[model samples]
Target: MGPVVSKFINELSKKPRIERFSKLISGLRNFNKTDQKEIIKELESVMKAMDKNELKGALTVGVFEEIKRMIEDRKLGSDNDYLLMKCIGYWKAMKNIVICNFGKSSLCKRFELMIFEEMNKKEGKNEKRLIGLYESYYLLSDDSIHENLAPIITSCLLKVASDKEESPETEKEVEMALLALSEGSRGILVKGAQHLQEITRIIFHHNDHRNLTQLAFQCAWRFMINNWNSNSNSQIVVVKYMNFLTVVKRELEELAKCVDWKREDEEKENSLAEPKATQIIVRWLDVLGYFFIMCNKWDDDFYELVRFIVELFRTARDNEQEISEMCAHALKMLAHNENSSVDAFEKCGVLDVISEELQQLKLENRLASDCLSIYLQIVRRLSNNSGDETDEEKRKELKRKMFEKLEEEGLEDVITSFHETLEYNQSYYDHSLSLNIFDYFVNV
Candidate 1:
């Protein structure tokens, strides 16, 4: 016999099944670390030289029987890391070998099913063991294995989501693993959105990892956005998922505040580290901005939508142009609703910022015309709200101040458009004038 064969037989003869399995796994470490194609050829050669079915039969029986015997004899300690790692190595080796040869097929499915069946049986007795099985499955990267393993991963994630006793660390690890698996097999996950939402909620609530939460949001967002077109049942699910996102947004806001406060202190001690809180706030604002814009087309709570725009402006310090443009778009939305326009003016700092930008435009480009249009809409709305002489005086004062600002900035075209729109509104009370002005400025 060759060295490898003789060494394997000698170990198998001297050691118990578990110890022999550990040694076998130790011997295969270099093989697993090499190129999978080479590993596959070597494993195939070994399988051919040794009886494949006989080895599998012996290993399966030996492992299962030993586990049972340990349980009955009360000899098995809680720590099963060695045994679990051995199982992981064996399965991972088989998985890599199979993937390097044949693509995903019935043979791989049979292997996955057998592994899951074994895990499911043990899950009833020990959750940690089942988790170990899943972690092992998660570590394997064969796309074929992913395709075969997605449903099982989804089921396991769902169980973890529902189990209150599972630690947040374990849940976060599983969530990341499930995300990686889902990236390889999207369709299987689309069919499992209900379970996915449950997992989303668990992660959103219990886990504190930002990247993990972001992945959960992305996964759940895909499901919700796609299923929005399905039946009412699916639509309801989508809404619930959106509501969960809203909760997550709230949590993120709180965490962001804490980070901001902490970073302020850190900056005092170390001046080189740039604060990333602005980036995080901007990301969430962008998501909220899109969400509000989508919902505002059908909903009447325009003030609620404008509050997010106001928050964006309040938080934005350095990126004035970007925030100003976003605020301008949001104001355009509110301008369509007469009641919302006045509330937006009172609630948002758009007027103050637009005035500042317009002043700066004397030296810079007159791109402040975009904000100028929204300010004009607010003035028109305020003018319309006025009935008495004093209110009319205040309205004209506001309009005169805006026109003077535009004139100083050399935005003659904007000033002329505003005058023409006011005159047209005076003659015909045309709401369409606002629409036309909004279109002209938005395109500009």
Candidate 2:
């Protein structure tokens, strides 16, 4: 070991936490005094030992300022490869700390420019180069700094994902890029809406990789939900152009082919297929549920979406309450859509499924509270819209058929039983939902 590293390690062991920051800053300042690798490694060790508050203290005393200066001085030197590697290593240790405490510091502007400059350089298909720049960007990417960095970040991520490189390093780059996009700020997603098609393709391409797929889905979900109101001109353009529903529809079809609903029980026992496939389906279902609740433009694919959601709900593990709850919530949103027709729900077997679940609940002599609350809300919405047809004669005919089906399925009796059960148990929220369902039924 070199003299500087030996002394730094000795002092690190002897100094208090706050004093360690001073030693760390001093070590970084003396980057040229020791062998670059030895000094960089020891510096990382010192910085990594500090907790958030210690790192915050370090920041208050200008640790990042030292990093900025060292990186700049090395950039002017000839043998930069070693220092660049050290820089990436340094950032790997400091990224999370910097991200959490970035808001409290005034060094954001310099950090932003430093990252952008590194990312913008043409490094000739070097994965390490891209990785270093991306790591730097990941550390600097905050809601406060995203506006300046988003375009380059998006462009770089799209390029990387499109390249389809296969390596552990490339995978890390793609994952970080996708994470940044996934957690983008409110208008950030809307601003990137024009690239939704490319992002959709990336999602499809990476569907086999669970982490990549999850991040991509999260990105799309954020984009859709964040700009849901679309009150501004840019938001309106985003809503008009982005077709997230179509993507959701296509993904559901793909999932349908992958999993055999009838054999799901057997498949669950295979051990190899346990959580990975289940998690992907859960996230996609979450996206679908949120899409229905937020966007009102699903009329084009309403029937297919409903059919797919209902089938998933029908086969969902009855013992796993959260999955069932998500499916019910999605259906409930669909039921409340203004464009939804009673005939469409009837054809898609939605009405039959709800009735069957209610009957099953009676046989079991139990109520799944959350699912029941949403199911009751669905029933009330459907009943209230029994007269949704425009022509008076057709509206009356639809109302008559809906009422007859409701009676034949014993929905009235089961719903009434649910009300009595909630009242007997004195449940608060679900009891209110049940009362509203009864009001709708009585008025209808």
Each candidate: RMSD: 17.6, 10.9
Task: Find the 10 residues in a row with the least total lDDT in model 1.
Answer: 94-103
Candidate 1, residues 327-440: lDDT per residue as tens digits? 555445455444332444554455555655544442212234445555656655654646767756665665565556555655556344455445444344333334444333
lDDT of 2 by residue, 217-305 (tens): 55445444543553444333333444455556676666546654455544544433223344345556655555555554434556776
Off by over 4 Å in 1: 1-164, 174-249, 259-280, 296-302, 319-444
TM-score for each candidate, following the candidate numbering: 0.38, 0.52
Whole-model lDDT, candidate 1?
A: 0.43
In TM-score terms, candidate 1 sits at: 0.38
* Candidate models: Cα lDDT each: 0.43, 0.53
